[model samples]
Target: MKQTDFVEVKQMQVKCVLCDQIEDIDDDALQAKRLRNRKLNMYLCTPCNERIAKNTKKRHKSGNFHLFKEKKDTNDYL
Candidate 1:
């Protein structure tokens, strides 16, 4: 096998879970590596991620969005 064959095989085709858009990413890229290693981090195309971020910001401006954060226990330091 030639080096080109390895390169071609290393290229990964991923689909965005939100928009179903297909994108080719280098297997050695950090995003590709994360996707391959982690099950929870699903792929999202640039557009979908941007749209979601925009909506989240709009919700925040409405003053009704609440983020539940875990309260740190001060007793843990004892």
Candidate 2:
């Protein structure tokens, strides 16, 4: 007679929005929890996230970056 047992592992598969890279995340991880709670749907791999940050800093230093403020129409009858 013999006894065998196996434990199952939990993994969440996520795709990177920028490079479309497929990666697995531990189900108990905070990022996975956020996704499960629908806080954010987009996922970016480490490389893509870093690249964007680097480029944004360069653009900001070059004075070519701009953030447009939203215009709101005020009620004319005041």
Candidate 3:
């Protein structure tokens, strides 16, 4: 008997968390920031880069945060 290595990837299928316009993404840029040795990937559309700024503002003002949880999807782009 042989054992095979299984790789599980979780993806989110929501409209780009940044733009909130593009229902989907083509070739977007993913940047990873390190926090406590954990890397967090941030997804954004070229035009919607400003959304990140806006998000920061909301976090600063209301102390509220929105996170995009990963779901299982085959259309994930690395």
Candidate 4:
């Protein structure tokens, strides 16, 4: 990529974990900071987030939205 003249501020490049879309976000944003600090933090685009929210709402209204929790192994240490 060629360096443009209006390249003063730095942009944080992030990829959506689900959609794999590359986007540029403000480096000073809170989300960017969280992503940089946490390894498990995932970044989702606006459309993907909206779609998940809509589907979750629909499932909740249907009374079949069950959040399955992971089974933790019990420790045997005395």
Give the range of the ten consecutive residues with the poorest summed lDDT in model 4: 69-78
Report the candidate with higher TM-score, 2 versus 3. 2
For candidate 4, lDDT tens digit of each residue in 1-78? 557866767789989988999989999888898998995399988799899899988987665423322112223332
- Best of the candidates, TM-score: 2
Name the lDDT of candidate 4.
0.78
Model 1 agreement with the true structure over 1-78: per-residue lDDT tens digits: 998766654778889998899999888888899998895379888889899999988987664423322123334544
The candidate, 2 or 4, that scores higher on TM-score is 2
Tens digit of per-residue lDDT, candidate 3, span 1-78: 334445434333434565565433322313322211246444455557676778778786664322322322323642
Overall lDDT per candidate, in order of appearance: 0.78, 0.79, 0.45, 0.78
The C-alpha local distance difference test score for the whole of candidate 1 amounts to 0.78
Alpha carbon lDDT of residue 23, candidate 1? 92
lDDT per residue, candidate 2, 4-27, as tens digits?
345456899999999999989888
Per-residue lDDT of 29 in model 2: 85
Ranking 1 against 2 by lDDT, winner = 2
The regions of model 3 sitting more than 4 angstroms off are: 1-38, 64-78
